[model samples]
Target: MRKIIMLLCLLLFLTAAYSYPQSIQAYTAPLTADEQHVLEQSLSIHEIDREIARIESQQNETERSISELSEQLEGKNEQIKDIREQAGARLRAYYMGEREDLLAALLSVGSLRDFISVLDYYELIMDRDRTVLNNYKTEYADLKKTKTKLESVSAELTQIKTNLQLQRNRVAALQEQVDTTLGHSTDPEKLMAMIEELTKYWENIGLYEVRRYFRALSTAMSDFSDFLDDHKDSLVSEKGGYRLEVREEDINAFLRDKNERLQDVSFEFGQDKIIVHGSREGLRLEVEGHYTVENEPENSITFHVDRLFINGFELPDTTRKELEEDFDLGFYPKKIVPFVEATEVDIAQGTLTVKLKLSF
Candidate 1:
């Protein structure tokens, strides 16, 4: 009887050890080579889009500068032309017996005062002619400099246009490659139609749901940790374990406040499932969930959590709930609600699916 009791005690201890909740961990799922390639390509496409936009913006700025320079050159040329005309008139007047003309004007004066006024007027005309000649030389020099600068600017503009064209062509080629890889047709019209169909499908299906959840999940976990740390004394239960009750709004606030944190988590989207992997506090957690669209009035979608592993250990429902409560798991769906018109959640087959009606 003593041996039997000892055996039972050992068995119970083993069971308890296996069932005990461990620390919150980050997760990673197994991926095939093809899936990995597809994910990489998708990320590359986003980067390519950014590059194309940057190049296009630079091209526009260059074109605007070129136009303004061209206008300035035109104005400079006009000024040069007017100066040249004035200089030419002054030269013709000087060569056309200017001295004889001045002498005749002095003889025609009626009095000594009129003669003195005529002499002053002759000196002013000669000085004005000299000023005009100086201005003409300056204008010619400026015109030459402006033309040189204009030529240089034109060359730069041409080079920028060529680069812009190359970027566009590269974008087109990448788009083509993406289309082919996704089994889309190379024809423009057909590709557009496919895109439309895919857009509709994405909207109606649960693609974005997984994305939003994981994003919110990461933030909620981080916030929950901080909350626990801040209120560590109060959060401690009688058993010396921590228990936290997190509402949906709390998670939503963290997610909205720190949306950029979503980039820290990795997401792998497949036709039927989404695999999310992230690390927090030295522990890795992975969640694999599948979703289906519901034809209800609310456009409800259901995501079924297929598997959840923390540090390679499968999480049971009881422990998972404990982790959720401790880590504020319910807040993830709440974070997604504001972006969508409405949201509903259903849990089945060890999975949670959130159906969302997008506002936009």
Candidate 2:
């Protein structure tokens, strides 16, 4: 059977990331000016910051989209007008059963050096209205749809900006409240108690679940190392080292069986790095990173997180480094099989290869 006991433990723990619980009786108070009589402590600064960043990114993207769509929509109308004008002025008499007038007008329109030159479908049809208007109808519909999309995205951008402003005001209010509370209180003990309550809010918001998620990832890595050790005796050896290649499909199957924790995330193998992206708890999460050989010539290789994002909020370098070091998803093969050390790790296309060598 697959080793999922510890992995499941991680999964079960991480699912509670949004709501941090404690044995202490929870604070009871009104949440905000809008939410009256709700029994809860104030929202954490970290949560508000994340929300603002996510909304701001969305607003920027929407503005760019609206600009591009407006330009396209503007040019589309002119294109349709030109194509129709060229078709009517040059080819209208052809379907009118007047060959002489058709030939004269077609020849007179500067050798039909207009939309006819652009479209170049003159020889393909006698029904100019049907052929040229075919393109017109499609272009017109696309132009209309572009208008609709532009309007929608513009509205969305407005709402995103509004939300961002509201979040900013909340942060300001929070700061003002904290400052006022600290200014009035002369007792050091009461101030420390108030600071501790805020700390609790920060710890409970989402940090606990994030750590649990990392542990689950670590457990999966350890299990893979154990698998390689158990099968080392029967594995093929080349160039004095053993190589194991696990494909993306293989990893997905293994993870699904090993731990159901990261159900929302999917992993892709790049030339040298692993790409992870998915929607988690209504936020888009993206991670790009790779593993490198142990720096101290040890038995393990460590995962170095290059980039991480939630919605569009990037994790700070300091916090990212802390997470990477604290929950390093490393494989220590020597601990499992004596003298065997992981020498190299690389990701290519759909596969992740680990090369192990016996050093002693």
In candidate 1, what residue range of length 10 has the lowest lDDT sum?
19-28
lDDT tens per residue, model 2, 1-360 = 255888887776665443333311133222233221111113334456666776788888888898898899889878889876866754655667665654555566654456465234444444655767677678778888988898888888888888788878877776666655556556535444634553453455335555666777777877875554444543457787677676787666655566787676577998999977655443355778888888476657788888765433355443456578778676776665676777778889987787888778
How large an RMSD does model 1 have? 24.0
lDDT of 2: 0.63
Best by lDDT: 2
> Best candidate, TM-score-wise?
2
Model 2 vs. true fold: TM: 0.42
lDDT of each: 0.53, 0.63
List ranges where model 2 is wrong by over 4 Å: 1-206, 229-235, 295-297
lDDT (tens digit, per residue) of candidate 1 on 75-181: 98888888989999888877898767887988899999999999898888878989999999988888788778778878887887786677566657766676665
Off by over 4 Å in 1: 1-33, 95-119, 184-360
